[model samples]
Target: MPGVKATALSAAILVSAARAEPLKVGGIDLDTPPSHCAPLRDAEVPKAATLGFVSGAMTASAVYWIHREQRRRRQPGKATHPREWAIWTRLDRKKKGYVTRKDLKSLCYRFESDEHAEHLAKQLDPWGMDHINFSSFINNFKVVQMMRQAGRLKLWHRCCGLGVAGNVAGHMAQAGEAGQESHSATKPAAIFSYYMPPHPYQVSDQQADKKRLQEFPVTYAVIDYPKLPGACKVQVEPELGLLVDIVYTKDRKRVDHLVPRRVAAFNDCSIRSLEGAEKLSMKKNWGFGSKGISLRSFPVDGFGPGTFVDFLALVSYMKRDGEVFQYSVKAPVRNYLLFHEPLLEWIVEQINGQKDTDKWEEIFPQLAASDFPTSSWIALGAGEYTDYGATHFLQPLDEVVVVVYDERVMPDGPGMAQVLEMFEDTPAPAGSVMLHQTFV
Candidate 1:
């Protein structure tokens, strides 16, 4: 068997190949690529509902009859959708298209109601045709996963990637996974935490006793100084954020699928010390911008392939006393503590089985009640801290900057070998996704 590094390369190539063309699995050949064409004109579709109803019924009848006649005229086996256009081209006897909304519901691996199916059909049929155009459809839908409603980031259960908190102990434990061997006795792991925004009112017994939890106020972004509570020490945890799509059974009691779609630079910032802290979340949330994430993101197309994310690197800096200090070691996302498909499966298992303890909070009940959250944003984990970052805490008038950039896009020359090489004297470069925040 190939070593982990070789296996990773093989997996990446497989993922890239799957993305490049129609996929066939389990001995089933898929549909041929669709022809390129502009969306159908508005004039081709009836405007009024009455006209549409009548036309739709007539069109259905005509299509059904024509399809039946065609099937009768063709040879027995040839009546099926052409082998080249196999799965993508499931010629519906009634719908008059290769694929329909019902087919999409099954193929996409998510179950939906009638209304949801119609909504998907409307989005896919840009020209008002009920059928989807496979090529254009793949270009738009396959790359990104969106939530039905913009879910409150507060609703999200913020999970912290741990096992990187200290220098010698944490580093030694996780080093082999970072090096070529990729196997380890002490596996790096993640812990669950949650944020509670400051609110004036007290939690009443009526609210706490209810089956559904009350919604908390959400602060998704901040550009200025954040209000630090009391005199607690605070530090930023620079990491990458992964947005995942989760599907659940109709009963909403259990999760069926969990897939990552987009990756963005993230700051899993936290307080240095908290009194009687049971879970890490107590250190995580304080107020608006308590956590930081870049406004920009890239899709994880075949995540292992690195086609979309490998070029990126994470670096953070602190501006204090009129001078800038590198606050965290520059690390690539691929060098993260845990990643790829094994990590993905591990996370799903963690959510389902993790129990409430003196040091960790239970996640299974929260997830089940939230219907497995159609979406989740997860921080990959933090990297090695700089000397200054390890010693100093946030003080008033200090500035913190975190950036994620495509190192592959770094310009050539003696001064520009890497992003850090260009960071000595100048401000952050143009293409990097940067977040600059000040302490108040």
Candidate 2:
């Protein structure tokens, strides 16, 4: 009887401990939001054969353990649950820190039919890389979660723009972007304010909002022409913008994850003259209405081949004195040097690794000091400008329009005549996202 009582007491203590600790998968606490999880530590690279064998054994063990635990704690009418991390680990057969299209397809087939799984695989691997690292995996996971959780708009303020990613020959020289040629395409060239919706607390605490407003200022939402100060030349840098969710480390020293949710047309309007500018950001944020993004944006279901993003193309036009002409070269979004998943991966690296040297400023430290915003609107890169766009600075009443549209709607690309028709048409062309701004 004493032995039985002792056993009962031990069981009670074990149950108490289990209840106290949160469920964890792959050393990550599931109870905590994914955004708050600590950055994944570097793991030792395992030899191929050994990695395959060990990973296979570990995956099998984990599956069995999870199922056994679930059955023991099962409640009536409850469905069996498997964590996302578990699925990722199982698919990473070689434990190579990434998963291939084949792995994704195989797993997807379980819930989706074979045809659907194949389609999903294509959507997941839009860049045709055939494999995706953990960052991309988590990004896709978060995208799904966002789609499911509707109503609340993700809060974001800053817009990070990438320079030289245009890869258009001689564009830097033409734009007179000094030191831009030396900067790597993978890194962000400048940061500007895009959105700063007043917080409820700001109603009572006006000073807090004022301080932030003074720093970032209002650079986006250009409805009218931008007021150019002094003898400055302004030009539109037509680019694709991605609205993404940013997840930083608990300490906020580093970016832990990025979830790209939407794609839109962006104008990284810039001052032609450097004048007193020492850094790229100095020329970027001139004041209110200095930059622009299309009011209409398309949701990014996935980054891969058959997804919504894959069909998109970018083109810009300028209307001056009642005449419309192509401003930036008509190019598909896929034409950028770094795009889709690769671009997202590069952004993560730059956010965490880019240093303050020469014309570039350190971004991570700034984000950390600024209360770690949960989201950002990133301008991937500008497209190469046509002769007219490069040579002509905005005169009073000049109209700039940047469009991101589905190329499948016009497979062979549109002619100048068709483009002009689009420019003149009211309510914009179907299947297109447009950002139109006129200079005063």
Candidate 3:
């Protein structure tokens, strides 16, 4: 009470009074009407009277109480409507927090509710606004039937690259040399694992004589070059990631069908110099944002032959010391040995039976533990790295960029020539999934 202001005390009293069944104002009961001796019984001093008649204390108290009530109503948890929260979480992944007309349009398409997209947009952007602050939008509107199911949706990562391209043999050799094992039996492999950030067992202050486990060095969209044991060298593997719908059989409970929903730019970012590591995923999983994927994605239906993704190519760039250089081969998706249905088939097989090797492990047992996740991050391998990107390792302050876009949508021109022309442009073109990760 020593430092408490009179107005603050008055507001606190008013809020306390609000909780009771019969409200009392300044010790005057409202439920029993007014007593003859009540201070405000016959007069409208606080409500209708001007400054001349009302005491300064009373006026200030009224103003403070109203302000406090409005503030309380606007608090985040209570204020954010359920439907708005649903739309926010859905958009949070795709839009990365900001919502615009274009974003809403895409969301509508994803949810198959385009008819209500404009209406919802109007609610968030009444005056035809541009980007709606995610918080403001969620606090204002409620959407029906748009709630995604509640569950701890595990994010599964599927790394691809058996023998497609990008110097598969060369990588295998490097892996074998690091692990001191023969490379002859090495085959294409995939890992079905989710990222786990640093746990109590993973981190410690006292440096051990052996090797220290690397932790996830970042939290947001940016990737960090983690300091690891055994002369570590980190590199970015530019790959295309897919979000799929899994179909499971009742009796088997295994993933029977894989339907790719969306495709986006992904950096299957990894560690290159691991000494005698048993599993490939050991070098892969460091923590949250250890890998980079674009929040924006293109539907997969139009991505097959003669489709959008068929004409699309994956490109990568690395920026160092104000200079940007091509980091990986701009390869077309169709060029990949296995793609579309075939790629899906290969992934399922790899999950079920691919044998483990020194360089990589099949992780079938791991998948089984997670109940064979239907949804996963399918990384379809990185393209050929540039001579410089291949040799040079990632360092702090370095920027890695990966983009996926359609060449068919480009201005009419020759086949591969148009793609080359498109890649030569300084910045990534529109309608492209450009994932940017700043290492540090």
Candidate 4:
């Protein structure tokens, strides 16, 4: 009877905490519900006065429960909505704990027309990712619903860039021996053209116009096949892509904060032939579908050691003529020379301080003039390539697969045989992000 009474008391406390008006205990606002508790407000609250008997023990228990609930709601990686969790479970029929566009599209077709289903799937996956975990699913669902109601459910765009960390084993030497000899290993270069401005910048002279046009390549469409521009040889540059939130200064001249939200596999596919290329970005993007990013991504709790990031590793392969070849040396993301908070700090410095040099273009002005996008996608750096990867250039119909997998699941990394088997299908490993792109 006492346990039943305690359960009832707990239920009443939860209801009181969901009330609109503040429930104060020693000036603490217990009724101020957490953001995730919006649905809780609709529940009926039993009057505490009706209980007829109030004990000191019960009052203390109520206060403790409210405080604990508040703390639990604020923790990272927690699902925000009950409805979204239910929807995710239904869509993830394979019990993979995540849903993909294919899953959503298949389910949507049951009720919506083919075209409508496709549009709904695309809108729900604004990032064009391969899989949507519960947290991302909830966020995407809310955004798409709001945009649909507003009649603006098109593609959501953000300004982003890549970091050229030259210290990843033999990556610097593989890029070019000259860069290895001259470039500082500690400082990474920033190539800020992952998503260019929608509109071109107006300039006075022809030279200035040309400079602005150089930064206008739309290169973030990684889910599609890449077109080989002209007869130039193209190769895939496998790297880790960080989806970060950018906070700009009030004046909008500088970046104040760069918080990384998720990490995924990315292919900063590049042109091997640099003829007439004055800057690095010139070889980076050749128009739409020139770069690649995995449809799958893992939430980043923190960048430090012993965090979620430490468990991940990067490896890549090339599928050619029905044969698979190892492309990149299997490397842990933590093996980078600069990572964690130091890596973020370096990126912030580069965004604000990088200038127009013969090798690199000015970045801050492009971002500033583009209204300072709130979010960015950054490819950290390419890993060292194997001899086959270093010598081979992507031919027509060659498919590149870049994977970021949890080492905790597969200690030795993903087997190439298994990778080839899953080449045309969804990645089999949980917590793995794969970027599969074919050259046309």
Winning candidate number (TM-score): 4
What is the lDDT for 340 in model 3? 63
Residue 71 lDDT (model 4): 86
Instruction: Kindly list the per-residue Cα lDDT of model 1 for residues 302-401, writing each as its tens digit.
Output: 5665566667778787767767787877777677555667566666776766777655666667654443446667666677677777777776556566
Top-down TM-score ranking: 4, 2, 3, 1
Clashes (N, CA, C under 3 Å) per candidate: 5, 2, 1, 2
Query: For residue 412, what is the lDDT in candidate 3?
Result: 27
Model 3 clashes, total count: 1
Candidate 3 TM-score, true structure as reference:
0.53
**RMSD to the native, candidate 2?**
27.1
Write candidate 2's Cα lDDT for 232-328 as tens digits: 7778888888888888777776898788789888887777775666666666665555577665688986775567887888889888787888888
What digit string (tens of lDDT, one per residue) describes model 4 on residues 1-440? 98987777677677667874455554556657656675433333444443534566688889999999998787433134433443354466566867788876665443333455566667667678776776676666764333222221122255555555464755756866235553446545454554555433454565344343334332221222334345265778888888888998887778897887999888887776666677677667665556766545788867777898888889999878889999989999888777888888888888788888766777787776666667777888888889999899887556678889889988898776669655654445776878666555
User: TM per model?
Assistant: 0.51, 0.56, 0.53, 0.61
Per-residue lDDT tens digits of candidate 3, residues 367-393? 444344445656776666777877878
How does each model score on lDDT?
0.53, 0.62, 0.57, 0.66
